[model samples]
Target: MQLNWDSTEELRQAIHTYIDFYNNHRIKMGLKRQLWNIVL
Candidate 1:
């Protein structure tokens, strides 16, 4: 996949969004768990 960002902030935000989804919302089938589990 190829992506072009207009600015550094846009690229940072995109990475942050992906990390948030990976840690919180995305489920890892191999691990059978979220990458990061938060208890609050």
Candidate 2:
């Protein structure tokens, strides 16, 4: 895939947008959630 950006801001925005989508929207199968909260 070829990405065309007009400026530096556009490039940063594009990268951040992709990261947000990957972390929040996309689901990872077999990803375990840590449920224990222990204070040392």
Candidate 3:
């Protein structure tokens, strides 16, 4: 997919926001394996 952003900072901020949401609120079956592996 193509991500269109106004500037580098915008893209950076968007990526940070996605990362925060994924880490904090997103639950995945793979997360159990990740936890065991300490991948996060």
Candidate 4:
């Protein structure tokens, strides 16, 4: 995928947002095993 950003800061922020959503909202069966390790 190609990300077109006007500045480095914008690209960084977008990447951070994507990572945050992937970790919190994306689910996997193995996630249950580590449920206690996640705070939210």
Candidate 5:
């Protein structure tokens, strides 16, 4: 995806947002052997 960020601050914010998602809200796997399915 192309981010139409017009300034350095916008790019910084986008990177920070992605970092927060990577740390918190994305996904996880347990020892029970569960799988994730993506539905379009």
Candidate 6:
């Protein structure tokens, strides 16, 4: 993926959003449909 951000805050926000999705919204088939934070 190619991303262009004007400032550090924008990059930080993008990373935070991706992490939130990965931890809270994404499903893990290998873990039997559970979120990452729940497993942690």
With a 3 Å backbone cut-off (N, CA, C), the pairs that clash in candidate 2 are none
Minimal lDDT window, size 10, model 2: 30-39
Per lDDT, what order, best first? 3, 4, 6, 1, 2, 5
For 2-37, candidate 4 gives per-residue lDDT tens digits of 768999999899899999888776566458757856
Q: TM-score ranking from best to worst?
A: 1, 6, 4, 2, 3, 5
Report lDDT (Cα) of residue 16, candidate 6: 96
Q: Model 2: per-residue lDDT, tens digit, 1-40?
A: 9878899999999899999888875454213332222321
Candidate 5 lDDT over residue span 1-40, tens digit each: 8668799999999899999878664444332234434321
Tens digit of per-residue lDDT, candidate 1, span 1-40: 9899999999999999999888764445534444334331
Alpha-carbon runs more than 4 Å astray in model 2: 26-40
Best by TM-score: 1
lDDT against the true structure, each candidate: 0.73, 0.69, 0.82, 0.80, 0.67, 0.77
Clashing pairs in 1: none
Residue 11 in model 1: lDDT: 97
Clashing pairs in 5: none
Best-matching candidate per lDDT: 3
Worst 10 residues of 6 by lDDT: 25-34
